[model samples]
Target: MTETIHPTTESANRYLRDNFAPVREELTATDLTVTGRLPDHLDGRYLRIGPNPLDDPGDQHHWFLGEGMVHGVRIRDGHAEWYRNRWVRSAAVADSLGEPHRGTPGERDFAANTNVLEHHGRTLALVEAGAPPYELTHDLDTVGPCDFGGTLPSIPGRPGYAAHPHRDPGTGELHALSYNWTAGNRVAYSVLGNDGRIRRSVDVEVHGSPMMHDFALTERHVVILDLPVTFDIATATEDVPRLVRPLVRGLLNRVIGRNPLPEPVIARIARGGDAVSLPYRWNPDYPARIGIMPRDGDSASVRWFEIAPCYVFHTLNAYDDGDTVVVDVIRHPTMFATVLNGPNEGPAVLTRFTLDLRTGQARETGIDQRSQEFPRHDERLTGRRHRYGWAVGFEDGAPGDTLLRHDLDTGSTESRRLGAGLEASEFCFVPNPDGTAEDDGVLMGYVHDRAEGRSQLRVLDAATLDDVATVHLPGRVPAGFHGNWAPEGADLADV
Candidate 1:
């Protein structure tokens, strides 16, 4: 007989009361002060060098401008600081690698590899590489030089090295996946030995384009997702007299800003190229999501699955039990809607699926509130067993925005609603070490208040979903993508 678990009256009542508290308390306050800006000298500059003029721009070096450097923030004590990367030169000797270097430091490029950091115990591992190949130290504070070994491979059209590394729990191997952006977007996988040496490289084909966005790995698989291409349409238009050029330019900018690519160009590219050719239109088979399952030693197989029709941004959480793989899918609307209409209308969904590793089948398990979007899933406390855990997502509903939590086993959910002018992102859970069975885990996330213009890190008891503490920041965190928590004394915090 199949077992069934229903939501208890007490549990329902508690959820009803606290469902909105996560967004209502002082943690949602937007009042913030601006701290000092990041040092301008630390910015990394890049040059376009390829066959296509607009696509490559040749030898002319272009600065990405460090003014918009602020993206995410982490805090300890009352003090808060912005997260930025330092550029370091590649050197064979340790002593030769210290501090102040020229030509945009290697560390800056390495920092661009990951949207956020993930921590395994105290050891923090991040995927780093840019125009040049290099791995940035995930250490919290102290700056160390970036390492690219020798003569890193380049991705054409795009000035960067394509290397993203993640740890495989089953084999305990650090695998780095490299792509040649300049040469038809080919991918190569290299294993990082325990001694920090890179093994042989094998070239694999996925597609040819810098449109790739994010990827993940499981005990038996690796997943890759590609983004749509961007086409500038304003350049192709009827010629106008000198006096009318300014007016035409103004109108062109407005239309291009809204639709980005013209209808004709979009059609031409879609027809000329194969599946991976055009950057727009979601393909059912060439999923925005790609998953690879490891089989025996070094060999692994790949699987591609589509979540939605639009651009699906994802965060992956894997379970050791081998029966499940949970992916958080965030749907990004077409450029036309975003640029013209703004962020008010687009909807988002949080989808969880159970993958039968042996059978090669993926089954959708549960979904959170549909009107809500931008789901951030974290399972830092799952450990060896995957039976019990918590997942979180945000819902932008009519009443207000809310945070929703899902219970894996019971398939029941709870949501906390926030009042007007508030938003939240990036949810992480900190587990207790003693192994005592009190509650499941501890919940932590960043709450942003647009009205007051600020963000706060809020912690709560995972079981009750009650606020335990709120760490206020000195300034706005400018909205970030993903984050991971390292237990106290983990190597990740030392830097």
Candidate 2:
């Protein structure tokens, strides 16, 4: 059973305060402090990106909205060589900073503030919901928006790129599911080959314009989420004043019981008022469905299975198991609820869903009932059965987050906590250069210390969940979104 958890939320603009606040200085520090012995096998930069607004949006700021900033910690020959921070120069950011914008004819020139990745020898900062990725240089400087060398198809004025794209470990192909708000209820599947060009593209129709942060890729199928949360017409129109919000909410609840109205339905009935214009809401009226489409099939070949209404921000991994496809993901009860400034939804738990292709039935099982999010597995086992996965845990009454490692085969979990007032972000597993077992690696991520007003890169033994190393950074890196372990010379083909 799903438990009801209402976390003790901070101030409405908590993101603008403390470690969540944007770092103003773009400084470079060399030969950084290392608390423990750095591993010899690691030789690359630990890169992560998040929304760091150039100017405070104050009360109107949403946690997920803002300009993007990329932070990098270069590790060379087991030494912390350098650490630097740079802002991904979107048109808005470039103009604010008095820098030159690079990308020409940018359709939707917005911040790529979710994730940073390297593709086809080019580093790109990415965002979801209809924005092209901003390419970056080796030193983490923005190189403008990239459209796969203009081969990326445009929804209108610009090509859409998703934040989370799964790279097939076996085939070296990158698969992504991108949705545009104006696409009329259809999501596109884009597959990039070894050369980072779109090798295959397909449009899959969905019920509503659901917020798809991540998807699952099995050996035989591409799993797509068509959930209840979708776009609202009222959010699109900016004419609704804030003074009439109570009146509008009362009228909307009376008619639809809090479920958001589609564009067509609201166009005929009502208008929306300003409440940060969140656009997507936890819509209970819309039925939740998951589409299991064959790898070589089109939209018509998809098998839609109705499931419970919930939201998933990140998926751990998925693979085929006999006649069923098993997908592990971070499940949230609802999103954009309670507060529009950030994701103050109920506790997010790690859940496993098993879809029986033979019977067309879907069943879900809770793995770790404790509050956890941002689950990641071994990329080497991307489309194959895996034994281990790691996630960041948010236990009630605890001051900081815990890093958890789950062994699916043994039904055992191990956890690592930084300290009393230090928070952890998504931990990425880096496999050992020469290892026999799957768990022979180190898990690395950023840890923000509230008391000290600083952050550090923590490395833990993946097998034992013990601290292996810690690089004390010069400044605090906010508890941000996803990141990866980019070892040197491996980024070109390091999907």
Candidate 3:
């Protein structure tokens, strides 16, 4: 693709310097708060580390925390309780070089550790720890670099982030896609063995922002959207001087606000290590959300869908049928301005797009409209044959928003408001394994009472959408971002 440079406006430059500089200064201050030491005491149920903690920081490993306190809830008989972990470890440390801070507490000492549960029933959690934690069971093998087939390059401090794994039906291989922000905006993939070993790693360059969301995977290939622009962390640090900071801040804001990467950049980046010129364009005011659908036999046959003008910074969920892929796009419409002014009155949407697998043709289902924030599907609700499910979240309206049940087939929506006082976050539906087919199962969500500084887990019947029970958590769950449900027999400890 040909590179084009758009002339930068003086007003835009002045806006960037004036409004964005302080944000970078504050981030620098936060970075300084990171102490390179773990606390003397960590009060947690269990802790697991990788094979070699002292190994090169770039090597991949696994760890577990709060293992004993983890328990799965069964909706059957209305008995909800925690089941303790069978194995217990008092206090275990990883071989990490820096002081460990629990991500649950929002400590900035280390990078966030994300757990991706693979489709082949293997749970692989990648801890973005600056230093490796203690080594755990030797039985859990280390995925050698050769297994990755030299597709991924390991950066020193910053490791790539991973999403939930997707399986390819044709190759019978588990494909895990990750974005390495530390490595010049590259996308990498690792093929997993049935025994849970890494089979291959290939580094694919994707332009735009260094961070990437979950990529779509099919039996033959992975699809990634290359966003243009470079993310400079030094500018994000607060310690930068006030005068020079404006320039840095302006650059950061412009890049984030205007995601300028084009389609050619995406294709070129996916083709492996190739240095492409950055596109010259106005600062990206919105976060770019790209949707991918992997094709069957053809490696280059992946389908790409882009949401223009509006950028998406939230999660992307998909439900696939034999011939088509249904994507759920949740966007934070006012995220850019919100960064400076806090939360504003902006709308979010749940867009459904149908992509033909064979032709790579994308047709919007005309289901685009304002909807709830962070609409997530229950794991138990998703299956190969099952196409219909419920998405629960607070809707947008005057007075107060209500919890909505969105029907995928009919494109009709139903909502129940939480009165004026109460507010709800995301919801999960847990199906009853032992219950009859007629019973749609249970719906669970958090009802946040900000005034009272309390949150309650509200459970309802999936079929009727009526309250079943409310489980009050101690010391407030602190308005979590996203969560998953673990059924009765499932090992919450595994998470």
Candidate 4:
């Protein structure tokens, strides 16, 4: 029997009410129907992980905080074999499983609900704040917390890892800017070798506990988006005393027959007058600044550049041109600035920042006027100049039924519409083993059709933005954050 979960009045917020609501069923299905020819050489699993809360959150709910559930599909020898979904068993999840937590404790607890990628011959489920990575098999089963085969370095009070670590394709080294929510004013920059051992760790100074979701890598530097979004525990609790506010509201609404307070008032309370918590808030005192540290140097050698206040959740790509650094990113006006459950600002569009090191100035420009999110590109050319970029296109703040492709060389774009009521998730670029061009491979992603109430896996030609194939799924796949293509040999054997 498949269990279905629904949104409750306990939290009358946006994230828990519509497409963002969590699904309750766990399923494993086989031999799904295919709409087009599956490539013969494709042999791997395409997996994605995102937040799915198991317990009641009520009004304190934020999209970034929740238990993680991973959905995957397997393809082999030109056939769609199986699809599976599982919750990452953190200590909290393990308790519900009648087992104990499996890893060393960090300053923050584990959720593993963000991104899944293969590193050092092992697959890892990762989150941003404080948990160590949860290792998994190629088949998507948990293998406990991985300290990189017992070689990843650890600090006394900081134990968090960045979800979007950049792996240098040239040197086979992984680079990450790890930060802890509790450790204010300090962050760590660490590098791991191809052998899965820590190579170097350096502490960088900052103003407050900023939520640095993702950074950018260039040929010579690691660009940091040290913007205004910060962590404030005290303010987060001012509006809604986790225990008292809900009870008071419940009594007034259920027992006294009151209609409850306005959402703006509720939002103000949830923010404690100011948006606070590990979630994130825009800081007015701290000016938005961009810093660049030499990949082979320390924080003391870092150069800082200033920009207008804004929030950036993800960076598409960055490269050095002569004495200036060019970065492409998904730019938002402000994050958590209003009372809405999610971002209340207008749509995020693609923009480029040119940081002139010689003059210490930064200039912003538009790359594409279309509103979009989840920008991605060919990883083989990461930190280097590439010809193409891709993102899930959006109509408003909601997902649009199309995927966009940008040609850097000619400043042209192409859109591949997924029919009328279908929406695509963040997709991965899988390169052809024998292809030479960067855009020669296919783009793979999950698509949900609202009219049919089902989801499917789609494959599109990267060069032309045309549908190549699709595999219909037996169950619903909720929208998610990030994922990667795990090839056949990315396992312990490769290590």
**TM-score against native, each model:** 0.56, 0.89, 0.57, 0.87
Worst lDDT window (10 residues) for model 1? 45-54
**On lDDT, who's better, 2 or 4?**
2
Q: Which should have the higher lDDT, number 3 or number 4?
A: 4
Model 4 bad stretches (over 4 Å): 1-11, 103-107, 150-156, 236-279, 490-495
Ranking by lDDT: 2, 4, 1, 3
Candidate 2 overall lDDT versus native: 0.77
Q: Which lDDT values do the candidates have, in the order given?
A: 0.38, 0.77, 0.38, 0.76
Best by lDDT: 2
Q: For model 2, how does the per-residue alpha-carbon lDDT over 1-495 read when each residue is reduced to its tens digit?
A: 322212213535776765567777786889988877788999888899888878857666777777888888999777899888888888878888887777663646777889887667778788988778888898998778888867776544122678899988877688998876656567888898878688888988777667788898988999998887776545544455667545654554443322333444343222333234556767788888788999899999998888888888888999999989999988888876565666757788888899999999999998888788778888988979999999888654122568889999987888877678788887899998799788999998898877677778888899998888899877778767888877667744545
Better of 2 and 4 by TM-score: 2
Worst lDDT run of 10 residues, candidate 2, spans 1-10
Among all windows of ten consecutive residues in candidate 3, which has the lowest summed lDDT? Answer: 21-30
For residue 6, model 4's alpha carbon misses the true position, in angstroms, by 9.5
Candidate 3 regions exceeding 4 Å error are 1-78, 82-154, 157-159, 163-175, 191-196, 216-234, 237-307, 313-316, 319-324, 337-345, 356-361, 366-368, 378-386, 392-401, 435-439, 488-495
TM-score of 1: 0.56
